[model samples]
Target: SLSLRPANSGKVCSKGAFNSCAECIVSGPNCAWCKKLNFTKTGEQEAVRCDTQENLKTRGCSETEIISPKNIQQATQKKPLTRFGSFVDKTVLPFTNTNKEKLKWPCQDQNVQCQPPFGYKHVLSLTSEHQKFNDMVSKQFISGNLDSPEGGLDAMMQVSACEGRIGWGNSTRLLVLATDDGFHMAGDGKLAAILDPNDEKCHLDRENLYTKSNLLDYPSVGQLAMMLDKSNIQPIFAVTENVKSELQKMIPKSAVGVLSGNSDNVVKLIKDAYSSLSSSVIVTHDTLPDTLSVAYKSNCPGGDKPGEEGICDKVGIGQEVTFYVQVTAKECIKPVSFNVGPRGFTEKMRVTVTTRCECECDDPPMKDNPHCNGKGQVKCGTCRYDCEEGYLGQRCKCSAGQRDEEQLRRECRKDNGTECEGRGDCVCGVCQCHETEGGKTYYGTHCECDDEHCHKYKSLLCGGNGRCRCGKCECNPEYEGNACHCKKSNEQCKTGQTVCNGRGTCQCDQCQCSRGYKEPMCLTCPGCTVPCQKFGNCIECLAFAEGPFQKNCSQACPTTKVKVVDRLTLSTEAKKCEVKDSKNCWMDFTMEELQGFDNYSVEVLREQRCPEPPNIVAIVAGSVAGVALIGLLILLIIKALIYIKDAKEWKNFQNEKKKSKWTNADNPLFKEATTTVANPTFSGE
Candidate 1:
């Protein structure tokens, strides 16, 4: 940033203004270590030091007020006048100002003003606090640089950076400068007098001081001239009195100069420069009254007749003169061109243009740069251009280009009358029309716009009538035509089709698919049956239940995304389910299963009915497994039968106990009687 060098710039610094200066390092910048700021050079080999900047004091500085150039010169609002007219205007100027004391004159007279040659206002203390001042100047010059094709943006920004803290208008440009920061000698400062290339000093000291440590590395005073010519800028260079020689080398001889040792001197230099360069006509060259006089001097030097004073001659080819000239040609005449200079001479041209006329005119003659016959009116009714003629902004309402008829309208009009619609353009009371990047031009009385193609845009720029504008196919901001067709895509609604596959109406360009359907394209339906498929996976709901959708079994086979190569039907084993199951679960003998059932097939009940239950191995395995189960069941039944028999025997035993109870009472006597009467008791039974 010190000198705005590119990255890796130091490696390339072998010659030119950059070599001797520390090459403006890209990293580790310490101004003290950098050779540019008179920094020390000892540690430079080991540790590179860049221009280290101190933190700037950024806040709480009083702002410089934005001075409106027009506010001070309300009395001289119209145009600048010649010396004689200026005297009169000055007399009456103060009557309008309520604050008479504040009304300072821009200057006395055009010739009396002492201005620097080419330099205009240069800046000094336009700090961040004065950002408003910088902003104002930059705003006026911004133009359409935002959209400019080339150097407009960079030029505008750079010029704006150097704008004066105070502003001046078209009446005149003044140069005012103040420099707070001091400067150093950076490059070869040896003059041809001090060390001529032929001298031994030039040969010896070519590497330092007069050659190395000099101010030549900084942007030179000559560059100011180049910038001035390009940007129409004028400079007022201010520097400290101690570096007088350095400042002298840094400024063009013609530009305003200031040598200030302090801030007070700095202010005085600014005011002095402002006073000096406050007029349009500067004494760039001076010869004398005799040389300045012409036939007009014989009559009226300001304005007169033949041999009258309004005429002037200039330096032209083969006809050289000096000072300002005065000629006499009272009426309009044919355009005659001359190579304008002190030698320029022309007898026939009515218009005295500054291009060829080296007169006191601030501008080229009115006729040569004619915009209107009168002050604001166009000479004749003719449309010169679109909105691009001599203006800026959206519709070219402001002055940006060479002022032409369109520009004249905007300046002279007091009302709603403006160049473009204030949004477009005007020509002979009609809008010249505004065209956009897409070629849409405003139409109708008020510039209500449409496409250039109107209603038919297929062939026109806007389909010829479509009026393509703002990246939209439109009749205007509102109306629709051929450019905007009625049909619209329904993709936004997730319908994926333009017209709902011809089955649904489009509302707001959205498809409302018919009943029994869902999809962006409306090409699918939920009512479609899903096949009971086992190929990929089983569909439980369709398999377990039948519905209208699945009513068509074999006839209208259920459909799925998967391809079913083999038709699905009831299981083949279902027909043979009447047979007893081998596992006792079920028997659905399929033909394939039946074919493999040869030896392994067994009718367990028939095998058991064969009298021989099975082979020993089979019987053993079955007997072990079955007999154990049967034995368990039989053991359970035998336990039940034994329990029943025990109950019955207990009942009989109970009856016997009751009978025994009766016998016990007579047991002793009965025992003796029963043994004796055994045969007798059988006869009684």
Candidate 2:
């Protein structure tokens, strides 16, 4: 019933075996996995050969472990079964998550998501039209309202109050601050600060109020991020205008995204972001048309922008920036709201984007190219016209005419000669269209369908995928599965997931546990299972009188104890002690003596205690938790040491990155990272 194996040498196991299977050997999943594929075993696992799993005995193992096969030959030689694929691979079917078919392909498929200007994957990041503007805006982003010095002591008190309501720190939330304009602190012109409530100039517009709105006479973005960081919130920034290398240097590398254009290019920039990272959009288009309905997401579902795009970080410095964002009359004039949605399986993010565009999109259309038909592209097109001396083609744009069986092969020579500069033959009096690969057999033909693999002129000649199946490209591995699509499964259960409780492997359409496991999904925690459960008290008492608590022998106690103590313990509780032979003593004192005792207080003392309270269960739980806590503490110390070691080695990594940033790295307007989660405790696990 129990088989034990020790770690060894000369055994090149991909994974250990659960039960004997030639395909598995010392390196494979449990026997149950191989059994499903129809494999059987005999003798030692190492002596077995590869075989399929089928009709095998179930394995005995723990209930909380997922196991898979380690080798193929073990299954075959041991558990001789065959639902075989090919002789090339004789390993047993594994229950593990390892890829059964490791197909060779060109590249990995990536998901698409809009970036910057939208989406924050729990990591704060902003998007803007230009990198310079992004840096400025990020530097000035206010995750929460900061009380102005003008407001005096009350202002400071207000910030403290805000921190209390919001909490000081949270590791999971990200705050994004972005902009597309030049950085400063005001809705109107040069803003000023009014520190006192009594200051008539404190109000906006009445007196350079724009300046006064800033807690600092001139609130820098670096200050904001640092404040936010104190609250455990991270800030990522995106901008347009120019790359603000200075800002990038100040913030964490992962918290920022940037664009090189202006506010007008927001849509295109968002669409081009990569989906592999966090993303956000800070729409600068204040003038939005009511006619448009835009779907804004905090984290770009399609994806965040690719590299060469921006990704920034934040500085956790203070707690004030973790509450309500302080907005001036300027921000009030433009309505802004944060809308978040599910990012998939516990993944959620917020999105902000500009809906307004000031540029006129209805300019005159340019003349279409005769060859490309105005697609703004000219990969393979032809012209038809006579030459003006050395010129030729449909528009006489080339030096000579061309012709070939492949329609695309016929092109006007630009060198003013036939055969395209005398280096090639002329088909239809034109040079052949070339490809990165070697020249094709049908040199003079168009890219349509060919009898073999090449195409002469059909669209998607290889079925859009690379390979040609039945004269058409059959999609590769992942592509072959329902559609020629990529899979997100390669990474396993997305971001927030626990595959099979990390207990057992999914095998043969069922879960297979390791050698010592057993359970529905192999999820049995190592502990005692008591039978004195409330729901099953009667049945458990009869069946498991000795279950988990027999040492006390309360169940087998004397009947008198049960009749009094047991009954009273449930509904009420009191205890009584009676003295025997009192009548004989009373006789000696006579009836009067017995009567005098009535004067004494007749009080009953009661004593109570529970057999279960603070019992084995408590000790077990405490002992386990104590051990785990100690382990966790040790792990933390080790991790800290490793980080310190790395920091000691890479102290200059920060400075080197700064050197590669935008030319305006020294701009004082560029601030460091300040990020915070407005409310930490508010987030529920």
Q: What are the per-residue Cα lDDT tens digits for candidate 1 across 1-685? A: 0011233212221111222122323222222112112121211111222222221011111112110011111112223211100000111211112133323322224444222111011222222345555554443311111110121111212332333322322333323333443431212123212122111111113111122111122223344445443333344555555544554455442234456445567556655554443322212212222223233221213323433223332322333222233433333333233221211111112222222121111223333122322222111111122233453322223454446665456542335554444445554333444554554345444454443433344454544333454335544333334455434444554433236655455544555667555645455555733221221111111232233334443343233221111322334331111232222222222111111011011111111111333478986898799979998999999999999999999999999888863323544554443443356556564
Query: How does each model score on lDDT?
Result: 0.31, 0.30
Best TM-score goes to which candidate?
1
Collision count of model 2: 164
lDDT, residue 632, candidate 2? 100
Residue range 1-685, candidate 2, lDDT tens digits: 0011333323233433222332343234323222121111111121112222221211322222212322211111121111100001101112111232322211123233211110011111122235554454344321111121111111212222243222323223343333543343212112322232322222223221123333323234454435443443443444543535655565442244565555564434443322212333222112333433332212223324332112122312221111111112322123344432212111222323322121111213333443323322121111122123544422334433333344433443443334333334443433433332423222221222222453322354443434443244445444432222332232331122544445455432244455344554444434423111221222222223433334544443321111212222221112222221212110000001011111111121122222334588889999999999999999999999999999976877877877785654586897778866577667565
RMSD of each: 38.3, 47.7
Question: Which stretches in model 1 have alpha-carbon errors above 4 Å?
Answer: 1-128, 131-224, 227-232, 239-263, 281-685
What TM-score, over all chains together, does every model reach?
A: 0.21, 0.16
Winner by lDDT:
1
